[model samples]
Target chain A: MSKQEQLQQLLGELKAALPELKEIIVASSDGLPVAQLGESEIATRLAAMAATAHGLGKRIATTTHLGNLVEIVIRGDQAYFIAYAIGDKGILGLTTPAGSNLGLVRLEAQEYARKLAGIL
Target chain B: MEPLKIVITGPVGAGKSTLIRTLSETEVVDTDAIATEAIGKPTTTVALDHGTLRLDGHLLHLFGTPGQERFDFMWEILAEGALGILLMVRADRPETLPVARNILDFIKSRAPVPYVVGVTHLDQPKVWQPEEVALFLGTPLEHTQGLDPRRPEEAVRPLVRLLELIGTNA
Candidate 1:
């Protein structure tokens, strides 16, 4: 299968795994939306937010003498958004209901990020 | 003894750099300088801000991540081996709560570390109470406190308390 196809499949897998997720988006580190799943409008906003978050993560990496940011998760009362940097140019953004299995979500997100990194 | 690694972070213009410079007597690494040198432009730090201090014979390494959401990658790396976190917020910037929440989320995901909220610009009129700031950030009550980042002696006390909290929690 093509890389794009594989990425789509992966997104499908994530949605299936975490049915409570509100949105998932793939975005460039520059804040551009590349691909997405879930509510269209929310995905667009999330893509933008993910890009901004990724940029901030890069700054944090450079300032601390640590290497780079792998992932960042934001939790609210009813929602959770997790962004993971995939390689240098891309990020995987996931939004799930609050109180979901964070460990599982993180694990899947990391796995997909790695897989997508190989493709992108 | 080895220096304790501490990360100070918050929204833009929140006085993170000023706080570290005032509280620590040692020379700061000035990551912004490095960033400028690297990018060859007068760019703000796209990464971390660094400094060092000595207190009671122990060295404390201080790092400050950029407050903007675009440079968040630096937070993960800076967080490693961190003894504690000092979350700085400006009294005038109510928007800092979202940024603070994001930082807290990042920190909680890694390890449970002690953190103190330093409310900067408290000397300014119309400052929010520490309790109110805590509520805004969704942090536990009593975890937030007002601070004058320009005052080194005053800033160091809260920092020391943060370190103590880390020690106790760890």
Candidate 2:
């Protein structure tokens, strides 16, 4: 399968696993959208912002001697926006409804990020 | 020492980050990532590039905004309370002039600060002159000049001019 197809399939599986996820975006390290599910209109902007967050997170990690960056989570009053680094060249961003299972979401997202990294 | 905030903005590959790095006295904080598109550069700034320098005994905090439009929201954030702006445009790439103009308009609409346009890549062949760029950007010729961002002395011309426009000598 093509890389795009693989990415879509993985995103599909992730969505199925976490029905609470409002959105999923796969973006290149440079802020370009690779794949997205839900709200396609905001995908471009969200992907860019996700990459920016990932870049800033990596910098923060290095500056504070916090070892490798794992993820960046922005908890809003209504929802949660989480970004994970998929290897060095990609990022995985997800939005989940507030009150969702945070620990489970992180676990599943991290696993999907790893699979996405391999395809990227 | 008084702190003067100056914002450096331009399109991708216009040398915003390079200029800040060349002019900064302290270590620059940059958020550059590998570019997915072939924009003639390997990496692009996703967030902001921050640096500081002392100009005429005043501490200048320089913030370089990401060049892509998707990150344009940062322009207003960085331009907040900025005393002046230095907009960089690649002289060799006239096509980017419109985008540069849009960026200038967006920031000036919010901050209404003094600005100077730095026309980089003058050393390259088939490049636009500062006057032509100024005309296209609707900025005064005096506020636009060609400079090499990689060179310390040349890289600082626009900032100094911006400072002068802001009624401060650098």
Candidate 3:
């Protein structure tokens, strides 16, 4: 019934749908965690990092005339940190184990991020 | 529990970075670039600034925004889900009051969060006192304070007030 409760339910469903998702964070584009399923400390940093990352990405894109950034993906040895731009502002930070189906993960991530964006 | 997110904002040269540096035990990570255009300082924050502090077993995340209006977008982004805002302004530069007001209005527009008008430059004489600033900004005197951003004890006062507000609001 409350906004916080609804946020939790939304994130829970998304994680359930995406088994590859190790954790997910719905944060403001500026990088404040709204509702997250992960370590509290890391999630807090993830919000700030994701926001600053978005700022850098936007600056780079504008300077290079790259138009606009859609998503930013960072690949590590055993994990992936993929962030989707939810409309003009807001981001969905997804941590998935390596070797997950990239296509499906991205598609679902985008959809879920859009829904989360509306919720915010 | 997530650390209470707080945003520090004001006009150029308002001591945002210094306030965070003084308060945060961790080394503050900031994206400061050499100013292409003339401003008081050679270096200006381009992206955002971040630092962390632990109080009463709770983590607090501090995010500072670029003072220049060009980066007003960050103001909106950084203000999201914030427990409150600390609108830092210099005591000597009353001219920047308008900019501080704009930033405060912008954040208030997004979320009805509690905020304080932090008037820096307590060491400087002939500057507006916190009470005067509160009057100028149309905020209550209780919501404004004079502080030295370089002093950790003074820097943390606004945050302590914000935390109290969050507790009461919760």
Docking class of 3: incorrect
Once superposed on the true structure, which residue ranges of model 2 sit more than 4 Å away at CA? B168-170
Worst 10 residues of 2 chain B by lDDT: B161-170
Winner on lDDT (2 vs 3): 2
lDDT tens digits by residue: candidate 1, A18-97: 78777888876545567788888766566656765666666667667778666887888998889998786678998888
Judged by DockQ cut-offs, the docking class of candidate 1 is: incorrect
Judge candidate 2 at residue B84 and give its lDDT: 90
**Candidate 2's residue-wise lDDT over A64-119, tens digit each?**
99999999999999999999999989999999999999999999999999999889
- TM-score head-to-head 2 vs 3, winner: 2
Whole-model alpha-carbon lDDT for candidate 3: 0.81
What is the alpha-carbon interface RMSD for each candidate?
Answer: 7.1, 0.8, 8.7
Per-residue C-alpha lDDT of model 3 across residues A1-120, encoded as one tens digit per residue? 887788788888888888768778876654557779867778877765666566667666765789987888889999999988766556788899999989999888888888877776
Instruction: Please give the CA lDDT of all the candidate structures.
Output: 0.74, 0.92, 0.81
DockQ of all candidate complexes: 0.06, 0.84, 0.06
Candidate chain B TM-scores, in order: 0.85, 0.96, 0.94
B124-165 in candidate 1: lDDT tens per residue? 787787788888877776667788878877678667778778
Q: What order do candidates take by DockQ, descending? A: 2, 1, 3
Which of the two, 2 or 3, has more DockQ? 2
> lDDT of candidate 2 vs native?
0.92
